[model samples]
Target: MIRLPIKFLGLLLFFLLNVGSVSAQYKQTVLNKTQLLLNKENTIPLGRLDALKIAVVTPDAQKYGVFVQQLGRYADISSFGFSKYDEQTKYFNTIIVAGTEGDLSQEMLYMLRQSLINRKNIILCRFQEVGKNIPQWAPLLGGRITELAYPDFSDLAQQNMAMSIFGGLAITEGKAINRTEQIRLQYTRGEGSGLNIAKMTQKIDFIANEAVREKAAPGMVIMAVKNGQVIFEKAYGSHTYEQTVSTKITDIFDLASVSKIMGTTPVIMQLQEKGIIDLDSTMGHYLWQAKESNKANITLRSVLLHEAGFTPYIPFYRYLKPGDVQSKASTSHQTKMADNAYLVNHYYRDVMWPEMLKSAVKPIGNYVYSDISMYVMKEVAEHETATPMDEYVQQILYRPIGMKTAGYNPRTHFDKDRIIPTEHDTSFRKVLLEGYVHDQGAAMAGGVAGHAGLFSTANDLAIYGQLLLNRGEYGGMRYFKSETVDMFTSKQSKTSRRGLGFDRADPDPKKEYPSRLSNSTVFGHTGYTGTCIWIDPKHQLTFIFLSNRVHPQVSVKLYDLNVRSRVLDAIYETINEVK
Candidate 1:
């Protein structure tokens, strides 16, 4: 307006653009003390209370004790009845007084005052109304009390602020208590503010109905997590056409190729961190037989990125003849030949390794997804560590993170009822595959292979997803250095758009696997048995879809159904709509 010089105007424009970018990156909300106390903040830090002990005090200690236990999953938390207020204040660093049912006892009030004097943080929740004057702890709690005609009628005018706590739990709006009881808080701003729970529910419901109507599958389990919190999780349809048993959140599903990432990949990452394996090192470094083969020059990085020239797969199980029925001899090498059992005639390492080494290697520098690459990598990892892949991953990764249901050979640890059936194998095995692995190759590998044969529940997968989002730390323990995580997740090749062991967001928007709304930083993998794990680091989002789409038969293509991608699209659209 003042006819400023052209250079000055350009500088001003650049400054404005930079400001906008910063605002987009860190969207902070202004809220009053009361709002801050009631609402958790967005982008909550991980491992917030790792070093400190917390005690949750409530009048109904038994009732709120359940919430405390859930919070313990992420933090170290203990429950204490009001009677133990004095003792808790003496030991714990922070004390949370929840519920508004009863009047404050003088001893508890005195202890809170002393805690304030000691500069100890105290979180108070007035969830209900009591017939008494406002307690003196109101000022300490960063809020002023105003008498109302009804105790339950919270003033909406004062609810203009929001805060997030416990990593992705958000408290937003003018005191709108939406999904308040749930510990995981979701924010209400920009795209996050407009998340349509109703529409999301409807979408999954429709897909489940269509799947059943079209005989795609009898049941499905969908779990979506944003910022280390589960936003949507549901089980649809019955176990089979018979409608005998209903699917549950606790039920574990066959993960198929997802095993590559969740099982083998993590172990490899750990080995790299321990200086036991190098991505650039040749496969021949670990497998002595590969030292002389064409694969001798192939690097672990190339194999993981799927550019190692290995063929997609080999049906080695087809070569095995029917074992002697009379020889009921079962050892580590073989399973008892039964009607509903896998016929493992010999040790996989002795028989399969030789065959794998003999397999032809195609021309290098091409993007060809190959299960054989993972199979070889599995052998390499096991040989280098002197541990079986399954046992190593269990002890080093799964058990440490409390992923109880995540492991190979589910029949060993879980009950049959807890494991979902994958298929009725009529081709090779000729039996109903329940707790056993569905992949013929993995079944022949004694139910533990790199490309397939891992079972997990939605909740456990969410925990693992959160671990990655946290940059490989969970429950106050550091599993992988942040740099290692970044290295593995970074795009490795422009031509393939693949990470070390993870698949990045498709550059082509038209690709049906990742949602179009997903930014380029999102990385994940989809299993052949209707399982997928997509993580969007930019938005701190993770989505897991586990289903036995091949229950009766493995004919239905999930891509044609657009079930997974559409759900992802819907999630992003809902988040972005408010903006």
Candidate 2:
């Protein structure tokens, strides 16, 4: 066994104790700020609002939307303009009134009074005067705002106050603000240790050689994060066999099936917490088509678990042929063929939805790994929330967690060179898939589908995995309750080792993937385009592997080489050796 130096252990303990004290002090400061704003007469403590629903009320929502939206990153928040307030607005536990230049209308004042009478918490920004007499609501706000000479109205002051409201969370300046101190605490508490880099390097080199010999992938990028710290991140070989361009750590890859978990699953979890979605609720509750079809009885839980009786996938794109003309018409899906050549096509969703609704339902209770299930669930989620799936997930989850490189339809926002090419397709569009989704169904759906369309860098994926390891909390933001995370990640069915939207560690020792070193509590998912994210809460470990294994052409040779499984095994072996 590899023994850690005694001095290192002592230092680790000392650092953890100091960090704990510091964290407590920070919490106290935030509490004090809350008390100061809510006044001494307010009996309801600020802690009550921790898990409560919050909304930002503003007279001019568009003007102050960005500020409130920034706060939404650290808290679950909904926004409404002064004119939009209604009976539904009363449901919010905490209503924050962002200052506006105009005076508050009588209707607005009535709503504020009603909220106070309902015992709802209120936070007021002193940027503007709300009414002639400040004494009426001044007691609720602790004090009245008085005009002073030469006030320091700087970005730093705004950020500091926002941080206080969010319980001392540092907002994203230019880069991600990682909770490295918490990671250190988890590490020192025996959750994980620094990786055995030399051993892992040797193993990766051997694996790369094997992959080359077997003609698997020309290159690979692997990153392993343990207890929030990136222990190992490296790139290998060239972009492709034909192209000699060296791969970099920032290169994005087609995530394929990984999109199910990364792009769609977290959104479902968030919606569930907001009481907008229920796992046990039927699909018909959200989708109109499903309500009239035999799928009316299918529950959202079964859909997420892949037991919803949907087929694996349908070649929906096959119905639409590429047009010979290259025009920038808004009606057609324009795809880049070459430097100037393009393929313009349109998806016949009118026919597709009817056909899907009339399709016969298969018997439930068995796990049949289906992509169509996620596609249907995506539509249901979108319809229920009245927000596009891509936009909703990005706003609530990805942006908040600081996943800079994760999103769908990458070509619109990211440069082509940063996005690694996937395959040279001869059968479908007859174009090299660069900055385009490789999945035909998602591509036909305008490159925004639940099953397979997301592209992200290893760094962003690592941040997401770390968020899961932290039990759905990151950067002082609670995205989901710990119980909610556990509910989704825990095994749901006996026949299949499937969590709600995650693939659980196989109980059987003979199962492939999710290395034998992982405990039963571990859950993760893999993508068709050589990407995988495995998180082990038992060990506080997160492993991410990204590669263009299908570059130049799609092949199963990479899986035959078992490169990912071997690398994962090596990682665990190193961890065990250290322990």
Best by TM-score: 1
Clashing residue pairs in candidate 2 (N, C-alpha, C atoms within 3 angstroms): none
Candidate 1, 368-432: lDDT as tens digits = 99988788778888888889999898778776565758888888787888888878877677777
lDDT of each: 0.68, 0.67
lDDT of 1 at 259: 88
Worst 10 residues of 1 by lDDT: 18-27
List CA RMSD, all candidates. 8.6, 13.3
lDDT of 2 by residue, 495-564 (tens): 7989888887787788755786777767889998888998877666788888888988988987887888
Q: What local lDDT score does residue 60 receive in model 2, on the 0 to 100 scale? A: 71
- Deviating ranges (above 4 Å) for candidate 1: 1-194, 324-339, 342-345
Question: Can you give the TM-score per candidate against the true fold?
Answer: 0.71, 0.67
Instruction: Count clashes in each candidate, considering only residues at least 3 apart in sequence or on different chains.
Output: 9, 0
- Alpha carbon deviation, residue 522, candidate 1 (Å): 1.7
